[model samples]
Target: MTGEPILEVRDLCVDYGLGDRAVRAITDASLTLHRGEVLGLAGESGSGKSTLAYALTRLLRAPGVITGGEVRFHGRDGSLDLLAADAAALRRVRWNQISVVFQSAMHALDPVARIDAQLTDALRAHRSGLTAEQRTGRAVELLRLVGIDADRLRSYPHELSGGMRQRVMIAMALALDPEIVVMDEPTTALDVVTQREILTELMRLKDELGFAVVFITHDLSLLVELADTIAIMYAGRLVERGPARELFEGPRHPYTVGLLDSFPALHGERVRMEGIPGSPPALTALPTGCSFHPRCPFALERCAVDFPPTATPAGGSAVRLAACWLHEGGRELPAPLARSLGSTL
Candidate 1:
């Protein structure tokens, strides 16, 4: 979109638990979200995608601690360090400048309260200048914006359908017209058709409102259609990142290639479903050197002794970055990898 960056996350590290038992859930994860750009954070479960999102917004609870790094939020007023922002400052920024549509929309809403009340409460908390009547009018408009009727404003969360409730959550998040929105698997439980509908509506809204989105999900296939840039995370670290089209066309990292193969081809000759072998390594007991080396088919002798450096892949544009020794040259990659991503390297 060639827009100014609305949010920048640099070297963010997060952990869980006490010293001896601490697990590094996020390590040196960095990316930027431009105005109106959709940056997809894709990874398997426990890959630290959501952790990065939560840590950036300072929503991580006790036991989940941000150990290092910075979250710089560029808002209308100016630049503000989100990690260092105090309670009052955070209160002012959150909801007004940034908001989150958390995973599981059902859990996000209050079962007993009417949808209108939830929407107004957000407005009442952040936008005190709006009169009660104005807030109510805005609530109805928000529902309409999300393709829901104003008549449903009186309906409780439990009374609405899954898609409707999700739409309500989205409405609540956009109530303040925040500059950035963090959506963590916002369409997880919805049907494929419903999920497509919600995402289509979301992108339309984004185009209309010009708000940056940090969309976190495990579905790289879906991101290919919705995201402008995609960042792949593994074992608490970002393994590869590039434009969505380039990453899908020629993924340099073995993990990224495996992830692409895991999903069925939407518009190609049929191919067998090939899932990644072995389970993700536990953060507490991560393997030595590359955390993915234990399972990587292209693992070399050096892969066991030293961690791969995050650098530009061979012949790849500076925009394409990957952490894999294969990109550094000298190591002979597997025949299959060399055949599939030879140009990428």
Candidate 2:
């Protein structure tokens, strides 16, 4: 998972409109995703996590526009700027270099089409060199790979269960041997048992295939366990990004901490989860200064007036970066945030 990065996104800004009426969904977000690694993107419901994913794959529609920055995708052939990639360029990389497993299983699959056809569609499009027999054989193998019965390939989307469809989607994502799979809440609607099973299979597949995963979820504890690096977004901006162990052991940003508090631990004492207090601000009319300041426990007057820059201090702080006044101007965090952010164990 080391060496050169497979994907480098620099200051990617996605906005919905113009002038004062504009609403930013993803702002100045940058990250490098290496191969054979899982980079988890976590945030609240309206934190633009999904929007960022859509923009990365050129899936954003209508008013949702990628206004600034660059998305550089590095592959074996060379580097391709995704931001500048046209429809034809995107077509080349769609399922081959990169793929996505959407959150809603039902919405993604075609109800009228048979399970085998739906699963083989991407392969048929991207790997058109394959004959019909070859594609069909691959589809059957894919079903088995995802733990579904190959015999069920003839069944329609309505025939399979929720978990089954999700697995089908995963199999499809891996069909073209994609280097990166951007999964957008892949197990959202499934039961806990099903979710765990899917995650286990996904990890197994990743290990076998040697491809990287961009797992997007609002669940912090899940991300902490599954991802090597975690990126926290708040109101269209990345408030924190660091190694999962460092970010979860003691969060640097208030929003990240709030998200952690919201998820119940899978192990240890199963205590009731606390909500993040106020609902996320409307994307159309976002707050001034720090978006999380309204709900922050250690908010200062300056927090409401100016935006904070991301700064990584020396020492073993998990490469912590927080876009809050507490960490701005190379200043030490306030006593409370420091005490909380610097928690031992």
Candidate 3:
């Protein structure tokens, strides 16, 4: 259901500070988002999911810097280099072209402002042509679009439930009819039922509005159901990316296999689950070679001495890519990985 490429991130890097003390937060992470596609970014916390989203949208705060690479946004009018764009150009593009819904609704929303005021603020800024009344009307319409009643428009953020506040944020993101929306763990705090409702509403809205989405979350299972393409990150690098179904069914990377095995299957019979052992490497003191080699059970000798290049795994789809030695030069997959992937690979 995706169209032509809308956003392309190539070899993007991000650092937390300046000079020799800077911590590398994201490194050479690249992905393409087609129009109307839901590209899910999944990883453990601090794997650079939110950092990448912020960097792509040029929303990274002070002390956080884009060290290298390009972010190209292809809009209807023309292609724009987001990394190189100036403040004025970025202002024009943000909200109007790309919007973001932060992880916490309580923190993202203005505590003192009414939902109506919060929603209309974006319209007032980006949509100057609209009158006050018109902005309010549009806000009401947006609230309704997100399944929020117009009557609650006057309610403050604290007055609404967690889900309602999140929906309001989503409504605000869609107010400008942006081409893309970056959602950073928008449902993390909500109950399972509320999470399902919000996600369902989000997907429905995406279909109706034709907007691309970069959904950042730690939940691979949820992404499996919602995202068209899924990108997996580890130690600030994109280790795997492919069509959602393919990545889930035939994960080629050992780290990916570990992640899948960590989660209990819903339909299958009960079985023992062994999650990834050890912790992610600290950004400041990452291992010399493959960052994950210490924790990878199927790592080769070279994996401890040299970083593996991104390569297409044997029997994987053409678009699939995994940064692991197991898939290099048509080498046979490890027994554990093959068993985990079943006959899919």
Candidate 4:
């Protein structure tokens, strides 16, 4: 069950360079993550999902900067503007308040360090008052919590299996007991069976630990099962967002419908799948109006000239929002689009 809002991101924008040459990576993205809610950010590669995650945590590298907007973290003490926070303040908040489980465990973990040393490093940095023995005990307990045995504490990253290394990364993220955990494709590169196991363990741990999650992936089918709320992105902007089931069953945006059709149905009878036409537009020279109009099968005349405003689509849930001309002025969606969605709108 989700509680009050814990993190609020408003009109966030990110750019890759300075001045006129800069390419906008994220534009006016906004979303709220409630305490203990699973918020999934889904889009294809280069859709800015990872960029958004990195920006939220103030982990963006040089040349990639937050040009506008606010990211507020509401903690037990008080609310904090993460973008405006100083380096010292960010350090204090990073591991203790919000931690990240990066995409690749091999790249994330120190190759030379033992699992125990890697796990205890955060405790040493953040919980300095703890003695060395106490930190070691916490490391062992964290490993056990992730289903790893204490015997593996002395093993290096190369010594562990792919699944085990990923578990170790998760254990480190939970070591500080953060209020929020940002997982950027945490299950990537693993086999199908291992992916399911990791996802199951993650959900179970979330229930036990009570931390909100920001799960980033390109897999909409996966998000429908794992996320409470799903936000769809295209070319850097959020195109649609709603309850996961609603968004999957009755998507209001053409891009979303296209994505759903691209994936095979896991349970239903086998059917022909169609991929979205054309590639995403370059961020430097985005088309006028809706960025997705070039590939939208149901694009309107206005879609070519005027950007669609974000609005609640007709026949959609009150909490759902989509940015498309078809949904403007409470107009019913076109017949072909409605047929594609397999729902009345």
lDDT, candidate 1, 187-266, per-residue tens: 99899999999999999999999899999999998998899999999999999998888787778788998898898865
For lDDT, candidate 1 versus 3, the one ahead is 3
After the best TM-score superposition of candidate 2, give how far the Cα of residue 147 lies from its true spot, in angstroms: 0.8
Write candidate 4's Cα lDDT for 132-207 as tens digits.
9999999999999999999999999999999999999999999999999999999999999999999999999999
Instruction: TM-score each candidate.
Output: 0.96, 0.93, 0.97, 0.96
Per-residue lDDT value at 280 in model 3: 90
Off by over 4 Å in 2: 18-20, 266-274, 313-318, 328-336, 339-345
Model number with the top lDDT: 4
Cα lDDT tens digits, model 3, 132-245, are 999999999999999999999889899999999999999999999999999999998899999999999999999999999999999898998899999999999999999998
Q: What is the lDDT of candidate 4?
A: 0.92
Task: Please provide the root mean square deviation of candidate 1 (C-alpha atoms, Å).
Answer: 2.0
- Residue pairs that clash (backbone atoms under 3 angstroms), model 4: none
The lDDT per prediction is 0.89, 0.85, 0.91, 0.92
lDDT of 2 by residue, 163-185 (tens): 99999999989998989999999
**What TM-score does candidate 2 reach?**
0.93
| TM-score preference between candidates 2 and 4, better one | 4
Q: Which is superior by lDDT, 2 or 3?
A: 3
Alpha-carbon lDDT of model 2? 0.85
